[model samples]
Every structure is written in C-alpha cells, then in structure tokens.
Target chain A: MDALTDAELTILGLLVEHPRHGYELEHVIEERGVRNWTALGFSSIYYVLDKLAKRGLIEAIGPRTSAKSRVPFAATEAGREQCAAATREALAEPSPVRARVLVAMANSAALPDDEVAAGLAERRAALRG
Target chain B: MDALTDAELTILGLLVEHPRHGYELEHVIEERGVRNWTALGFSSIYYVLDKLAKRGLIEAIGPRTSAKSRVPFAATEAGREQCAAATREALAEPSPVRARVLVAMANSAALPDDEVAAGLAERRAALRG
Candidate 1:
C-alpha cells in the first residue's frame, strides 16, 4: 500500500494520545498551529477521520457528548504498528526539499543577480520572522 | 493556474541556467546530488520535461547533437515570469515539515517511552551521519 499521507499520520498520532472527537482534534490542530505545515483544514477534519476509519487505522471507541456529539476514535493495533513504522520512516528519511524557491536558487544564475539576492533576502526575513 | 509542481519548477530552474537536453540535465542533477532532496529520478526526467514543455514553462530551443541527439529546452518570457512568482511563493512560504516522524513525535506519548527515545536516537544518528 502507498504510505500514509501526512494527514493520516498526524490524525492517527493525535488519536494515539487519547480518543478525541472531530471537534477536539480540529481544536488541537489549530491551537497548536499544526495547520502551518499541514494542508488539513477545519472542513477536512471529518473527511479525514472518515478516511482513517475506513482504512481500519482508527476505530470508533465511543461517542463524545457535551455541547456537540461526535464519535471518538483510537488507534488499532495495526495502526499503532503502522504509526511506529511511519514515524521511523519519516524521522530517518531525507526527503528532498522540494521547494520552488530552492529550485530558483539553484538556477539563480539565470536570473538577474539583484533579483536573486533580493528574493533570498526576502526569504531570510520571512524565516526570521 | 495552479502553482507549478516541484518537478516542473526544478526542471524549469535548470533550464534557466542554460538550454540543455535530456542527458545533460540528467548529468547535472546527478553530479550535484540533487536527487537527495528531490523526487526526480532518471526515468522520469523525460516525462517531467514533457510536462514542463506542455505548460509552456519551457520550450524547445533547438536540438542538441552530441554523442546522442536530443531536444534542448529553455525558459520562455512567460516561464521566467512564472518562475519568479513561484520562486517568491516558495521562498517566503513556511511550509510545515510534514514528516510522519513529526506526527509520531507529537503522539509519542501513546508509544512506549523507551521506543520513542530509541527511535529519536536512531534519527539523530542518521542526521549526524
């Protein structure tokens, strides 16, 4: 099977901490600023949860009820195993820095020197900020 | 239009340096060890070249005749404009490190503590290497 998408791993990882409903998961993600690196949006949380359920990576352990009602999920044994493996792979792997900026930098000689330097300076500023 | 894919941007960036054919492009990528950070592979080079050409981010400037005959490609004016925009977006973007390992790290409370430490140690060793 194809490796779990980043969303899958993240959601599953959260579920590992404890059973959480969609709303709680969404809250944690936003509060923690996990959204910065993730394509996960508020709209997609339920969809991702469903996808995880269908894959048997997580299961509905119970329903969470307070102001809202939603199913709570926990990792399956297979999921825990998968998560560990995925974690190891993610941590150890040296996936390419596939940034378009890096590509531009690589070929900066083709661009005007001033533009290249200015762009890099802009990037540095952003990184610092 | 949607932003250029990483492969497209990388190939276009290479073209920006100078017009090059399939083999020369392949040689540069390998020589510089760009494969470490990129998903680019020798087999997909031609396909990526074709994709860029179709998008008009690159155009066939001429045929390069050497030990082998191949078409050489260069960035167009539109391509250059797009490259600059893409470059800025990529540079200024603080895209999340979407590694499964990170998810694992975040949810590591669910895993045994020793396993987490060992995994992290393994990763650190790999990075240091």
Candidate 2:
C-alpha cells in the first residue's frame, strides 16, 4: 500500500482509537493538539475521511448515503493493518526536525544583531501569550 | 513580496553568507546538515536560483548566459532586505514541531506493544550509529 500522508495517518489513527463522526474527530484533534503538529485543518476532516474510505481503509458504520458528518466512521481491518505498519515505519525512521527558526538562526547574519534580538523577543512574547 | 519557502530561504541565506557556485552550496549544505531540516534536493538548487534571480532577489555575478553551475551568485540589495524581513518573520512566528513520531506514539494502540517497542529500539540503534 502507498504511504499515507501525515494528515491521513493522523485521522486514521484517531479512527482506530474509536469510531467517530467527523465533528468528533475535529474535537479530538483540537483536544489532542494535533493541529500544532499536523496540518489537518478543521475544514479538511471530511476530505481526509473520504480519501480513507475510498482507499478501503475505513468505512462508515452508519448508512453510507446518510449525512456524511453525522455518520460514524471506523477503521477497516485493512486500515488497522496499514495504520500499524505506518506507525511502525514512522517510529523506526524518524523524520528530521524542520523548524524554520533553525534556518532563520543559521542565517541571522543576514539581519542586524539588534533586529535578530528583537525578533527573538517577539517570539518569546508570543510564546508566553 | 511573497514569503520564501523553507528551501528557498535556506539557499538564499547560504548565498547571503558568501557568494558561491552551485557545487559549493551543495558542499555547504552537506556540511551543515541542511538536508535534515529542508527538502532541498541536489537537482533543485538551480531551479531555486532561477526563481531568486527572476524575482530580482539575487543575481549571477558572471555572465547570465554562462554555464549555470559554475557561475557565482550573490544576493542583491533587495535580496538582502527581503531575506532580513523573511528572517525576522521566521524568528518571530516560530512554527510548531511537526514530528511524526509524536503522532505515531499517540496512535500506538493501532499496533501491538511489542512492535512499537521494537520499532523504537530500531530507531535507537539507528541514532547510535
């Protein structure tokens, strides 16, 4: 099977946690701070679900033709397997840290030292907020 | 001006460090562990330089029609200003960590405990090496 995007894997992992309606998935995502780490947007939940369903990795537990958002979706057995394998691969081969700040710091000489200091202060303020 | 992508900003920053040919950029990238955080590929360096040049952010010091790989490129004044602004923005609004392992650990119930343990062990060995 093709590798799942981070968004796909995240949503699939949530469903594997428990079958949930689209709205519930959004709630879980927000509660778990998934958006901070993954690019799964509020509007993209249904889109990701559709993709998962189309790939036969997940299926709606309720009537298929019913209102999509109201229907609870669960991971298919295949999805469980795929999610497991993807999870393992993700654990085994970690991705590198891609923080933009690292690049910015590396190139700090592009800006004045005072300006760099101010920028970092701004970041600190934002983080505190 | 449009915000530079991480790859573009990285390359532009390196050039701002000192004007260098394409081969030198590759060497510096390797030395600096740039690939760990950026998606820049070997073949895309010229493409990025073209983009920067097209936007008047950087310029080839040698003849424009000369062999692309051999020609040294430097940031224009405008390029320096833009890079400074970009650097400030990057430092100010730091992006959150997007580690896939975080997601994988959150979803570990998708796999058996032993498998997860083994996967982490494999990662540990890889890190040690």
Candidate 3:
C-alpha cells in the first residue's frame, strides 16, 4: 500500500487516542493546534477518513447518538501497522526546512530593499508571536 | 498572488543560485536531499514553474543549448515577494509531527504483542539509522 499522507497519519493517531466521530476529530485537531502545520479543513478530514477506512486501517465502530447522531471510527490492525510505519518515517526524516524562506533569501535581489527588510521584520515578529 | 508551493519555492531558490534549465533543476533537487520531505518529480517541477510564471513570481530568462536546448528559469520581483512570504510562513509554523506513529501506539491493542514490540523495535532502528 502507498504510504499515508501526513493528514492521514494525524487522523489515524487521533482515532487511536479514542474512537471519535468526524466532528469530534476536527475539534481535537484544532484544540491541539495541528492547523499550524497545514490547515485541516472538514473536507480534508472526511477525505482521509474515507481513504483510511478503504485501506482497512480504520473502521467505523457504530453510529452513536451525540447531540447529533454521528459515526465514530476506531483503528484496525492494518491501520496500526500503517501508522507505526508512518511514524517511524516521520521521526526518522530530518525535519524539512521548508524551501519558501530559502528561495526568498536567495532571490532577495528581486525585492525593493525596504520591502525586503520589512518582510524579514514581519517574519521575525511572526516567529516570536 | 497565492504563496508559492514548496516545490515552486525550491525551484525559485535553485534559479536564484544560478540560472538552470528544468533538467538541471531536477538534478540539483535530487542531489540536495530535498526529496526527503516530499517527492519532486519532473512533472511537478514543470507544473510549479508554469504556475510561478503565471503569478509573475518566476520567468523564463532564455533558452540555452545543452545536449538539447532547454528553457532556463529565473525568479522575478513578484516571485521573490511570494517566496519570502512562503518562507516566513514555513519557518514560523512548528513542524508537524506526522500522526502515523501516535495512531499506531494508541491502537497497539489491535496488533499481536510481538508485532507491536517488533514495530517499536523497527522504529528505533530506523531512527538510529
């Protein structure tokens, strides 16, 4: 099987934590600040869940009546294996220093001097914030 | 303009270092270990280049003759600005710990005890390697 995407791994991890319906999963992701890495829209979550389920890595436990009736998902044996493989790969790889900054710095000649300084300043502030 | 994708930014950075044809860009990418984070196939680079050119962030400087003549690229004023913005955003965000491992750990009950231990052992070895 193809390696899971970062989003897929994240969703699997959350499911492993406990069975959760789609909406609840979204809440946990937001609460945990996963959005800081890549924005996790509702559509993306459902998409990953569907893909995981198809792969036999995750299964729907049952529809539980919450404030609204919702279907919660739990990880499967295959899913556990996939997750373990993904985690090992993620932790093993050196964290990517995203190319965006490097490209900007390399091409600073393209920007007005003031704009370049301002951009850097803004970046520093954002990093601090 | 929307910020450049990671691939686009990598391409722009490479161009900034020195003008190069698409093929050369691909070569540098392979040599530089950038693919560890995400794969950069030939088509992906070309696609990103086209997108970057349309956004006025990158431009085709001129076609040069190698074994075969090819179009070399360069970063433009708008492109530099976009790159900077993307870089800042990337640097600012905390690197995501991709969710695969956590999910596996959480759902270890699904796996045979030996498999779970084996998985962990494999992860530890990969980390070391």
**For each candidate, what TM-score against the reference?**
0.58, 0.62, 0.55
* lDDT of every model, 2 decimals: 0.72, 0.86, 0.66
| Docking quality tier of model 3 | incorrect
lDDT of 3 by residue, A1-129 (tens): 566665677788777667888888888777867755543566668878888999899998885454322788899977766776666555434444333455445455645577667777776886688
Q: What is the C-alpha DockQ of each candidate?
A: 0.27, 0.43, 0.18
Model 3 chain A lDDT-worst window of ten? A91-100
* Model 3 chain B: ten consecutive residues of lowest lDDT: B94-103
Instruction: Name the top lDDT candidate.
Output: 2
Candidate 3: residue B18 Cα off by (Å): 11
In the predicted model 2, the residue pairs found to clash are: none
Relative to the real complex, the DockQ score for model 1 comes to: 0.27
Kindly indicate the candidate among 2 and 3 with the higher TM-score: 2
iRMSD values, candidates in order? 3.8, 3.0, 5.5
For candidate 3, write residues B6-84 as lDDT tens digits. 5667777676566777788888778866665553566667877787778777778784453322688777766556665
Backbone clash pairs for candidate 1 read A37-B96, A96-B37
TM-score of 3: 0.55
DockQ measured for candidate 3: 0.18
Ranking by lDDT: 2, 1, 3
In terms of DockQ, the best-performing candidate is: 2
Which candidate has the top score in TM-score? 2
lDDT of 2 by residue, B1-129 (tens): 557877789999998888988988999999989988775778879889999999998999987686778899999988888888889999999687667787788888768899999999999988888
